[model samples]
Target: MANALPLVALLVLAGSAALASATTFTVGDSQGWTTGVNYNSWASSKSFAVGDTLVFNYETKAHTVTEVTKSGYDTCSEANKLSDDDSGSTTVTLATPGTHYFICNIPGHCSSGMKFAITVSATRSGGTGTSAGAPRVPAMASVVVAAAAGAAFIKLALL
Candidate 1:
């Protein structure tokens, strides 16, 4: 019983640390997923790692986020896109370490500078922390952490 408090505290802290490690980057940073913004250049300024996320915000019907292979990206071809979305907001997690390509396949859109490539490296030893201002702990996780803390306190008091 005496050892439980430290264990619970450690669990809660570990969860928080995991959350802190991941980053959610908003593509184009206010300019959003639209034309005229240099997406590849935009990506160059940051370091991408597996587990990081890219968020594309745009008009619902105006553009589409098309994930494609290297060839597809080079040709701006929509024939074999890996994924496609036009939901005004798209969130994509970097699941693996490699260069991923994205383009807005709306005819001239891709040719007219509406595409970018991001390179994701394997996760680093230490977490980069949530630099994009995403919440570290979810609401449910917070509740659980609070309950565990309270129980630990009660146990310590009893001891």
Candidate 2:
């Protein structure tokens, strides 16, 4: 029964670590979303994860942020867009781990270097674990705690 106390404490710590806050990235930084800005360089400087968000600040009428598929992004096509936003200040949540593509749908904006692609890593913890964009320690620790607590409960029951 006493051993169970330490296991519970471990569980609490694991839960806290897993609940770390998500990061918010301002797309294009101080330059804001506009033509002539080097989006590829900006995107390469940061690592994106699933709970993170991309905040696009631009002029509503002058530009638009459009999410497109890989093929569309490759060709700079706006014909079949996955999602489009023209609110000038749009926020896109990274809910999945994969390559996401974005472009300005203005007539020649994408061709004028207004497109960027970001590849979200599988795990934010930066390890060889298989958690996929999530912290691995908390998950592994939770499993250990559960097993230890279960064994302790069984031992108490047998007593």
- In order, candidate lDDTs are 0.82, 0.79
Collision pairs in model 1 = none
Whose lDDT is greatest here? 1
Write model 2 residue lDDT over 85-157, tens digit each, in one string.
8989998988899999999988899988999999986556553212123322334566666767787788888
TM-score, predicted candidate 1 vs. hidden true structure: 0.79
Clashing residue pairs, backbone N/CA/C < 3 A, model 2:
122-132, 122-133, 123-133
The top-ranked prediction according to TM-score is 1
Clashing residue pairs in all predictions, respectively, total: 0, 3
The predictions' CA RMSDs to the true structure, in order, are: 3.8, 7.6
Candidate 2 backbone clash number: 3
Which digits, one per residue and each the tens of the lDDT, describe model 1 over residues 78-109? 78899999999999988999899999999899
